[model samples]
Target chain A: MIIGGGSVGLMISYYLLKKGVKSIVIERKYPGSGNTYKCATGIRASFTSKEHIALMKRSIELWSELRDELGVFYERSGYLWLLSREEDLRTFKTYVSFQNELGIPTKIIDLSEVKCLAPTIVIKDLLAAVYDPLAGKASPFDLILQSWRLLVEKGCKVLAGVEAKKILLSKKGILGVETSAGFIESSTVVLATAYDTVKLLEPLNISVPIEPVPKHAFITEAYRDLFKPLIIDWTTSSYIVQTPHGNFLVGSEIPERPSDKLLNRLEFLRKASKVWTKYFPWMKEAYLLRYWTGYYDMTPDHHPIIGPLDDLEGLYIAAGFSGHGFMMSPSVGEVIADWIAEGRPRVPEALNLSMSRFKKGKLIKEIAVFG
Target chain B: MDSEKVIVCRCEDVLLSDVLRAIERGYRDLESIKRLLRVGMGSCQGRHCLPIIARVLAKTTGLRIDELNYPSSRPPLMPIQLKYFVSDGNEG
Candidate 1:
């Protein structure tokens, strides 16, 4: 059984089905109603760590294959990380070398080259940018919708509107889950329930080091495409990308608030607009369409908690993606399914993501996280 | 209503047929259909298309419109120009 029907859960279900393993996905709400739909939809493999780069590099390959199989457009428009500080440039120079060694084609481009790639950008204070041609965005809507359709067609069941209340345990290890509907008898269960994964595992005394850090994002009305690449200002953590549908998606980190209410603030609009206009003054002409808030399923180390729990024989976790869950879903699904089926993850790097890493203080210190 | 000619979401140019097709494809709820076909995501923000789609869904799925999960709505009921929100040297 897979709990949580977001991209991670759905992708896990998809791969499990592909392996000829019958699995049931239990969701409290409808699929894609969670963080999947709320994401900024940026996909990239460029990172500071070898583990993240390797995993996401594999994810990008899977995403390409999924495009043809699922009949959805995985837009490879690429990503450009704008570095304003010299230290950030130096840091990314080392990161690019590591990424290149790992077979990811990422390069540091100067201001003139950056301008050539994105003409609308104001080349004023920017030092340099790391460009990843392989990185881009995908439609979360179609991905989930298509996955659901295919899963059902393949005779796999996805029980929507049913909440997994608790994972039922026996002395032997796994009994199944006691849900809102009733009890499901499954020997193996994967918790992909984002921050809610903590609540379910709490009763079992499995302390998941995950926090739901809320963030805001908004999009403008369909406008003329000004830039192709998803451009991020490194210093400000501000990002803007024109979607394939022509809407300019703009998002930036918001200041910490006392309350974690999922509400859009007027201050977010002011701050994000300030960053956008600073880089591209033409963005001031754009009309605000919609603004919403979603939480990042953050872990202590910023890396996701994947792999099985040592205490529970049949329990596995694939949650705590920080903010990159949607982008990493493809590879995560493949890895988790392999771990479940074969009792080991196909990739060696996935072993580093187990929940026990927190107990051992072996946190994967990831620096490429968005605020 | 001729589903092809009948437009449900005017902002996104979604037809009644489009919504019907989404429903036929098993997107039973308003939220799923909204994301699948962009049914209610537009300048109007589902204010106009939601009721129509809900009625359509209710009629087709045999579930009450109230029973189906409605998509969440937020502020700025209408699309607002960004110039209107420009800071006037007050915000520090």
Candidate 2:
């Protein structure tokens, strides 16, 4: 049984069913009604860390394979990080070399190439950009729909609007989850509950240090595609992308308190617009169509916790993705299914993301997190 | 008015037939329907579309319209420009 019916949980069920392993997914709300829907929609393997680059590289491969199967319109439009500061240029130059060495075709493009890629962008004070042609954007809604449809066809049980209140455990081993409705009897339980994973496990004396941080994004009215790739102002950690649907989706990180509520702030709008308009002055005329918020299931080192709780015999976890869960779900689901069915995750790097690392002081930091 | 031609969400150009099709496709909730067909997500922000959609949902799902919780409304309850938030000497 899987607790939390977000993209991660649903994808896990998808792979598990493919592996001939039958599992049930119970969600407090509808699937993709959470962070999966509110994500920046950018997928990339451009990272400073070897662990992230490797996993995301594998994930991008899986995304391509699953695109047709899931029937999602995935546009490999690429990602361009606009560097306005000298330090950022030096940093990205090193990152580009590192990413290229890791088999990801990420390179530093000059200002002239940047203009060719993102024509309407204002490149004043811009040095260069780190471009990853393999990175792209796709509709999370379509992914959710397709996954849900596949699960239905597979005859897999997915109960929506049912909340998992507690992880019912016995001293011997696993007992199942005590949900809002009743007790579900299952020995092997996977907690993909995001930040709420902490809450459900607290009763069982298992502590996963995942914090729910509020993040926001907004989209503009549909228009002609002005840019081909998702552009990020690296200095401010703000990004803008003209989606295939022709809406320019924009988001940024700003100072705000972490709250469970999906609260919208005028401050976020002001800060995000200032940075977006500074880079794409043409966007000033674009009407901000819709704005919304969601939580980033953050961990200490900004990497996800994926693997088993050694203390419990049949318990597993795949949460604390920080902000990249949606993009990483495909590979994560496959490996996690392998772990449950075939004894361990196929990828050795995935073992590093287990909860035990927090206690072992083995933290792999991912520095390329965008707002 | 014919369900096929009646305009339900003018902001997104969604028709009454579109909402019915979504409901037929297993999107029984307002949020799911909105996401699937872009209903109640236009400049009016569902000010006009939601009530009608809710009633349609109620008629089909056999649940009262009030039983259907409206999707959350974010800031700029009405359509407002981004510049307005950053405008100098302007009190919001």
Candidate 3:
């Protein structure tokens, strides 16, 4: 049984169906109604860790094959991580070295190359950039629809609007899960509810160190053929990408606050507009279309926690993607399924994403590009 | 016409008076009013009521018609039944 029908849960359902394992996905709301649809959809393999690089590398390969294999639409428009300081440049160089060691085609480019890649960028304070040609973007909604169709065709059950109320566990282990509608008997239960995973696991007394942080993004009125690659300025904590519809999607981090209100904050809009106007003076005249918000299931180390719980049998977790879950879903789902079924994976370090790391006080910190 | 005004979004009730009240609250912006009253967040997603609400807000707030901002467009763009999505188009 899978709780939450976002990208991760949907991908997990798809892989399970492919492996001929019977599964049912229960979503409190409709599928893709969570953070999955609100994602910026940028895909990349540039990470300092070998595990992240390998997982993202596999994800990119699967994204490349998605159109041909799953009949989905994906565009490899490339990604550019812009740097504005010497320290950022050094970090990019180190990340590029690690990515290269993992057989990922990533390299540090000069300012001139950055201009050539994205002509709209103002390169006055820009120092260097990490370019990954294989990195790109995909449509989260389309991917979910296609995956749902495939799952239905393979005779899998997807229960929408059915909230999983509790995970029923016996001395033997997880016997089943109770939902708003009825109870589902399953030997294995995977929690992929993103920010809601904590509340969902509370009944089982499984505490995950994941907190939901609000992230906001806005779109501008479409400009024909302006920006080429998805631009990430590590210094400013901002990124922008031109959508297929011609509108530019812009996002940035904001100070954390506790609120259930999903509405866009006025302060965020003012700050985001200032950042955009300063970086790309051309957008000063462009009208801001609309703004939306989503929560990031953040972990202290900024990496996702996958695999089974040490205390409980037949209980699995796949949350804490921070902001990268949408892009990394395809590969994560497959790796997790392999680990669950075969007791190993094509990439071994993913199994090391155990819950015991937190207990052992072993935390791995990465260069948080978004934070 | 006053009695004909309907409260579409239950989370906010958002009667025509509430919209005018938002304008009196110094919210000359349509997006601001929508955010305050949730006028466009019902199951219809403002499909049937946006233009009327915009006109009312404009007339009541004494703002020019073109000065009002458009409400945010959510995806799925249409109101889809949850059962239709899950049950392969066999509506419940």
Best model number under DockQ: 1
- Tens digits of lDDT, candidate 1, A96-190: 88889988899999999999888988989988998999999998888898999899889999989999988888889999999999999999999
Ordered from best to worst TM-score, the candidate numbers read 1, 2, 3
Work out candidate 1's RMSD over C-alphas: 1.9
Roughly what TM-score does model 2 have, to 2 decimal places?
0.95
Who wins the lDDT comparison? 1
Residue A22, model 3: lDDT of 64
Candidates 1 and 2 compared by lDDT, better number: 1
Candidate 3 chain A weakest ten by summed lDDT: A258-267
Question: Tens digit of lDDT per residue, candidate 3, span A142-211?
Answer: 6776676677667888776689888998888988988999888988999988878889887777788898
The residue pairs in collision within model 3 are none
Lowest lDDT 10-mer window, candidate 3 chain B?
Answer: B79-88
Model 1, B1-92: lDDT tens digits are 79899999998999999988888888899988888788777888899999999999999999987678998887667787665566575632
DockQ winner between candidates 1 and 2: 1
Residue A332, model 3, lDDT: 82
TM-score (2 decimals) of chain A in model 3: 0.94
Task: Pull out the clashing pairs in model 2.
Answer: none
- Candidate 1 — number of clashing residue pairs? 0
DockQ of each: 0.68, 0.54, 0.03
